[model samples]
Target chain A: MHIAVEEEKCVGAGQCVLAAMEIFDQRDEDGVVVLLDAEPPEEQHAAARDAAAVCPAAAIAVRE
Target chain B: MSAPSRVVVVGASAAGLSVAETLRRRGFDGQVTLIGEEDHPPYDRPPLSKQILSGEWPEERVWLRDEATLAGLNLDLRLGVAALSVDPADRVVVLADGSRVTYDELVIATGVRARRLPGTDGLAGVHTLRTLSDARALRETLAAWPRLVVVGAGFLGTEAAAVARAMGAEVTLVSDLEAPLSDVLGAELGELLVRVHAEHGVKIISGVVVREVLASGGRAAGVRLADGRVVEADAVLVSIGSLPNVDWLAGSGIDTGDGVHCDEYCQAGPGVWAAGDVASWIHPAAGGRMRVEHRTNAGEQGMAVARNILSAGHPAPFAPVPYVWSDQYDRKIQIYGSPRGCDRFAVTDGSLAERRLVALYGRDDLVRATVGINMVRSVRAARALVATPTPWDSIEQGVTA
Candidate 1:
């Protein structure tokens, strides 16, 4: 499973980081979404998909 | 292990409904059921103080989306049904009618209620406005009561006073502070609000605490001040603040504080999420946890919760630059971002004397937030700045120009 994030639409609300901390991180300054690992392990697929679903800006993309 | 995902949403307000809509929008073909204590469908609450109170807009207009919208999405909406307990361990929500609904995911969007005056019972003309019923009752009372005494000078209290004054009711607005909005907007801006109300003939009483409600014939007649001053009135409107609805989460095994504790993704526990006024999530910027109770926060947080429920992995963190607006006496006050820790402010456009200006709050040489009074364009510009890391020097230069 892979999680792709579009940086343009991200508002840095940090909903994705709460779901999958290993796969996502927020910028220290402005709090924008930073994709730590796009292709997370298969076991973390569910959490990554959730991160994609909850992105307020619709910035996250999930591929399985 | 291939059972269909069952999502049960507790509360059909902005957060819950937004989650449902977001789920369907994201192509989630799962069973989505909404349980609400209110019999009516979810409605927009911000208008309650402005248009609804002023009689400019009707009840139906405040509704966010209608029954057709809900039906189109095929959402199972259980209106007027309250959740008695939430057994997160078993992933089930128990209702007041002894019915239990099991869910693979849950979203808690239960909002807050208006806080009432302490020990002011048995007074006929006392009112607190939060829901549709409260507005309707206050509207009826305002029609009969010639003089209206408002007990607080916060956003709601100020808006109500403006509406009541516009409706030809003599309004006496009392606040614990020397000026209205002192705690939130500071003394300078607070004084501006006081001036605005005074210019409209709304009697402003400041720095006075209400000792007791003076009643005659089991009806409110006036209020007694601690300084031995008596202000007579026909009706009293109490708009102190709100208390988040998190009482039912007791013993539910969910981490609860002043509100339901959630992380950045608005998730409280496994298969459980919360948003709106009742959810306090961690703020990365402030390095603390705070619950924002604004319309914009509710809508955005609700949508975020919806996506989190559909997918198991963490979504992006909920880090919206907080924004809120209030309309009173033909003036709109808009705030972008949080200004709690701001140390300095600079006026960019308009002057305080003109009652039309934009002020930017800065901390550690960065523009943290901006506030505009009757200045919409600047607020939009400020919102853009909040999304980026802009230095205070550049912000000042841009605003001055």
Candidate 2:
């Protein structure tokens, strides 16, 4: 699975990090999103997908 | 438990919509009906304070989903209709439009309404935000109103004040307590919020109560403070708090005090569940019951309830370390776990002088919650510890590094 994040669109609500911290991280400066892994394994797919779904800013996108 | 062949969900906000969507995602293909009083479809409420009100995001940007996508969900979408009564015994809901919808299962997600300034509701230019129209109306008036008077210093009021000041409007934030959010966040962090607002050019008035809204020519001109002082403003936003929307359930035989009381499973009655601000469930982690008004809690709890509704009685309890965040003056206050009534609180990282720190709420020398001010990564890391309730001395040892 492939995960991509639009950091510019992130408002830093931090929901993604809460849902799936393994795949997402927030900048210390402004809390913009930074993907820890562009591609995740099968075990992390549910969490990565959940992170993308709960984001209020719609910053995360996932492709399987 | 027998599988429900039909379901009726009341309230079309975040929690309600989540219940319906989660049910669909869980493969519940039975008849589903989603009812909402507002004509608009479900929209995100968090941005109403910052992005939408500050004119950074358009009104439609807050919509949860497009009409075509919502229609594709294959659920009966009832908008602009109010549910007058919920008859749990008969498994029927009476609508204001004289319609009766029977269901094998019911989910109450009718979230709270903004508590208005009692006498000021009729006054023009005075508003309380709990809906899309409220934000739209306030945003329109804020563009022209040079001075914004925000009553109450809680999250809603402070956020509104911050956004107004960002728009170059003069803002006066009035609070009855000496420090903002003191009872909830403890005095130190509350005072930090006060300093942050004051440093951002918002005039802070503490320990003063609002007596009544003063009107001029049938319009809100200003407010009359309890101490006989007047704060002039072209528009006033009252954000005292909210009351749960459970008056319709008065004779419904469901246990409700302040909010609908349910077990850890969100079960209010047989085949009936409640979620969001409207449902106060017994928290398994916290050992008490509390209703969470934040959007994240609403969404999580709503989804959990949906799964349990399909669980056929062997359901897991919805116990979580509740997390919520607030953005103001370009800084974010993020909290993990419920910190209300915590016995002890200590700073674990950074310093207050730097406008960045991580504070831990401890109970019995064990960390129960964490709050971060501009220290996102630190708080995010500490969240795992909160799930297990780490000890206080171990946290101090880690902080020494």
Candidate 3:
């Protein structure tokens, strides 16, 4: 699975980091989302998807 | 006793949609029915006060999902229909069109409706911003640059005031507090917002109660303050608060006092659950029952409900460090935890005069919450301060260091 993020759309709620800290982080300067991993192993797919699903701004997109 | 063969969810907004999506993600595949009162598909509400109001993005951008993605869920989608009542004992929900749907499990996420002043119904040029249609009407009225009076200086009212003023409307903000959002963000930060609004040419009338909305020619003329001072306007937006949509569950035997009363797990009754703004559940962390109206809480609670529904006999409590945010002009105000009733508030980082800082709220020697204005990273990091209610002394020492 591959993950993509839109910095402009990110509200910096940090919900993505809460769902999957290993796959996502936020910049310190601004809270725009930081994609730590664009591709993840099978075990991390569910967490990645959950991060996308719970994003309030719909800033994260996961392509499986 | 067994896994639910069919799950029925009421209200198709963020919380309801989250439950349905989570169920499918968990491979439930059961007959999932999602019902909504609005004809539009599930969309985000946070943008309605800003982007949608300012015409920065079209209505389509607010949709939570596109056509093809929603179709993939294969839901029993019922749009533009309202749920009249629920018969919990019979496990059936009666619809407005006289149709009934039976379910093994039920989730209610009806959310809330915008509160209006008494006797303002059907009045021309009087509006409330809650649904997409409400935003559309308010936007159309704002385009004409009418003299707009916004009652109640809460987040919704404050944001709408900023938008209308930016749209070149003669905007006047009237509220009972000393400053806008002082009741939630405290007077210091609230005063900072007052300066922000004033610098943008927005007139603010605070510390006065609106006695009545004046009408001339059968339209909203303006509002009369309790002090007998009158402010005339061509349009008025009332943003006082909201009432949870629990009236439909009148005879359903579910508690609807303030909202759908639920346990720590968001369960209302046997095989029944509630989420989003319509849910007033016991929060283990908050040490009491609470109902959050923020966008993030809606989706988070929905996921928790779906997980508990699938787990059946073994349900986990929904404990979260509640978060909420607001955007007005150049300021992005974000809050973590509950800041209401905090005995003490201190600027731990930055300065209030600069309007960019991190503040902490303490109650009974424990950090209760944190607020940030244009200081996103600091506020996000401060979540740990109140995630489990840390001691104020520890936070103070850390700040001093």
* Highest-lDDT candidate: 3
Task: Show pairs that collide, candidate 2.
Answer: none
Indicate the worst ten consecutive residues by lDDT in candidate 2 chain B.
B392-401
Sort order, lDDT high to low: 3, 2, 1
lDDT of 3 by residue, A1-64 (tens): 9899988778788889878989999876467899999998889988899899889988998997
TM-score of chain B taken alone, every candidate? 0.95, 0.97, 0.98
* DockQ for the candidates, in order: 0.03, 0.54, 0.66
For model 1, the superposed segments whose C-alpha errors exceed 4 Å read: A1-64, B1-4, B398-401
Name the best candidate (by DockQ): 3
Model 3: which residue pairs collide?
none
Candidate 1, B168-286: lDDT as tens digits:
99999999887668667766677888899999999999998888888889898999988999999999998888998888889989999888999888889888889888999987775
Task: Assess each prediction's global lDDT (C-alpha) against the native.
Answer: 0.80, 0.86, 0.91
Residue B129 of model 2, lDDT score: 83
lDDT of 3 at A42: 89
Q: Rank order by DockQ, top first? A: 3, 2, 1
